[model samples]
Target: MESLSCSLFSYPVSKCSSFTRLSRGIVFASRSDSKKHHHKKPHLPKNLRHRRRTELPPDFHPVLHPVPCEGPPSESDSAALPRDYDENDVNDSYDGNVVWESDEIEAISSLFQGRVPQKPGKSSRERPLPLPLPHKIRPLGFPTPKNIIRTHLACSARQPISNQIYKNPAFLISLARDIRSLPPEDNVSKVLDQWSRFLRKGSLSLTVRELGHMGLPDRALHVFCWIQNEPHLFPDDRVLASTVEVLARAHELKMPFDLDKFISLASRSVYEAMVKGFIKGGNLKLAWRLLSAATEGKRMLDPSVYAKLILEIGKNPDKRTLVLPLLEELAKRDDLKLTQQDCTAIMKVCTKLGKFDILEALYNWFKKSGSVPSVVMYTTLIQSRYLENKYRDAMAVVWEMESSNCLLDLPAYRVLIKLFVALNDVSRTGRYFSKLKESGFTPTYDIYRDVIGIYMASGRLAKCKEIRREAEMAGYKVG
Candidate 1:
């Protein structure tokens, strides 16, 4: 085994065998060296090399020993640094002093040091600021002078200046005219801005009227409050009139104009405004209040306006109570010229409200005025009587129609026939039936049938047959 070992060690190694032999030698060396080095100190890299002294007294060792560290070398030990490193080192030192401070403090320090930090080039925060105040804003492409601004602001602050003289109104009117003159796409925003400024400064009434013309009454109302609060600038009567007309025209358009403020105007124009506004708003109570005011003021209330109010109330069957006083008021008007239409309106209201006293008053008024009661008037009264089952009174009305030379129209004859049949007065029904035939008028088939049925039901079959034969002979069918 010893001879074999010597031969193996003495053999010259091939290129491939050299690698294998070297690896085996390293393994043996490590195993042998581990045991010897177990009692020795570890060595470090040459750059970090230090001297070692073994013969040290009992408690005496180097005063300072180097330790493995992660950061740059201390200033005292930086002898190996490059010549250019000092400049960078100075800069780094300065940065280190600033980095720990807040940005505001650093900026203030920089300012005090007369080294204004170059402002960042157009960052979002450094971009041009918006106009600090609304009045300072000018239209794009329109440079406003400070003097012009002061003049405009002074003009705006005047309490009583007519809006007509204001630049904003003039500007808006001109812009709008220009827009209207130009094609649609040219500077619409400019026109709108001018209009906004105009509205801000213009008369409330005019603004409201213009907005109403544009079908924007709510916007008009918004502007109106501003005008109203500035009592130094009283709106002209024409402006108030135009506003009221607009309100009446766009009755359904909601407005924020306070009705109380309008009513407080108390002028003729304001009274007119209140009347029209209430009518437009469909508030009959307010309309009536205006009417009462007109009467108290002795101002002539237009009959057409009164007619509209009464008719509107009568049309709603639930609002019958509102009709009576209006009719009575009309009846009591001595200076008022009551036309046939007015009489007709009164009769209709009386019919709806069951106000026979008003009806009687209307009849007396018509007779005293030498106006003939229409066939409709008589028929309505007859029908009312029939509804009340006052057959005698309804018959009297029929007689009065004939006596008054008023032709008994179809409705009149129908009511009479129903009333007589309801009263079981077959003889009177026969008399009216004969009158209808002799007058060259054929009664409605329903009326004729109703008469025949009444006779038949009363066991007067012969009379029924007789009436049927007579009706057939008069070009009437007996069904």
Candidate 2:
């Protein structure tokens, strides 16, 4: 029990306490569970505890229990066991040596039978294998900055105009009051030129907002125009929003003032945006008025501006008349260029309005603009020739389409079938009808009825019956 001989016997301990000698002179230390210890040795169960110099019987065997909070997760599959293993699991495999609890065995059995076992501290079931996800789950990332309500709140949380009193308030208030006093006929442009005082962009925006609250949008427009017209001042997005809001509140969506008078202000892009806004707002009349004004003022607006306007207006049959006026105005410009998309829109509008004569002139413009008419355009042109009793001209357009290697669309096929039928050309009609079927286009009831009439009039009953069956199959009962 004296100090243990260092070489003879050594055991890890905080202090070198007394050691007891066992039957074979093996030493064992009384370890103290002290605060100074960095790592505590693991505690083992009684049957698996360390034995000092004990001899075991010939058939004696031991099983090890899993120590918690150590190592990777337990494998559910027997095939995943480490080292030499078998069905009996009597070898040194991970599963064979470790003693499993009753609950763990049942859990693993249920897992193999497709019962998802909820893991400790995990809300979801731990899959036996790393299988694919049930479906693509969208990740809930951090709160997006572009959210509508949050952005609105953030904008509203900015320093308001009343709180802007400390940031040069006197000039903004005086300028707002001065603009408020002006007559409806007068604008800030007339008065701002008299003073050479430096003006901030925020000051101008504030004045417009103040005028908006005063219920005098005419006064607001005056402030906006002065800022827009002045080469030195920038009419930023905030200024534009305030002015438009004020004018909208005053029910002046259709501008009371001539839009072209300010077309030369600051940038052409500004007025182009305003024109597009008019079109988007469904004010075709106002949009057309602006186009006419831009034309008269010799301000060349973006072709896309009117192109978009024309395309939108042409969508409604009732608005087809509006398309012709825009085209005519655009025609006045010899240097004007239009895309094939816009020309296709024009052809549609022209076909609806029965403006057959204008197609020839449009072709000349297309050639001059270096844009080829699309297949839809050629279809409309051929239909134009057909309606005008110009069969040869329609055939000429067909030849042009073939030369352009344009594949026959549904409308084109129907037109060809009718065109040949109009001339008592049964062979071509049959050819087109067969091609239309090969193209996987379900013939319309009208086209089927027309083709059947052609085959019937020519005493071709078999072809007529086949087309009738096909029509019925297409969910159309052809007479």
What is the per-residue lDDT of model 2 for residues 138-165, given as tens digits with 9 covering 90 to 100?
Answer: 5666757774422233355575533344
Q: In lDDT terms, how accurate is model 1?
A: 0.58
Compared with the true structure, model 2 gives a TM-score of 0.47
lDDT per residue as tens, model 1, 1-479: 00111112232222111111222222000111222323333332332233243322221121321122346555644433333333232222212112111333333434433434444466565567675876556455755566543226454676434353343444434433444444634433443443344343333454455566566554444444444544444455655565665665567434436744544545766566656666766777767776875666556765657777787788888777776666666766776666777667766777767776677666667778888878888887777777666778878877888898987766777877888889888888888888877887777778878899999989988888988897798789887
Residue range with the least summed lDDT across 10 consecutive positions in model 2: 85-94
Q: Which whole-number lDDT from 0 to 100 does residue 242 have in model 2?
A: 65
Which window of 10 residues has the lowest lDDT sum in candidate 1? 12-21
Show model 2 residue runs off by greater than 4 Å.
1-261, 264-266, 314-324
TM-score of each: 0.39, 0.47
RMSD of 2: 19.8
**What would the C-alpha RMSD of candidate 1 be, to one decimal place?**
30.9
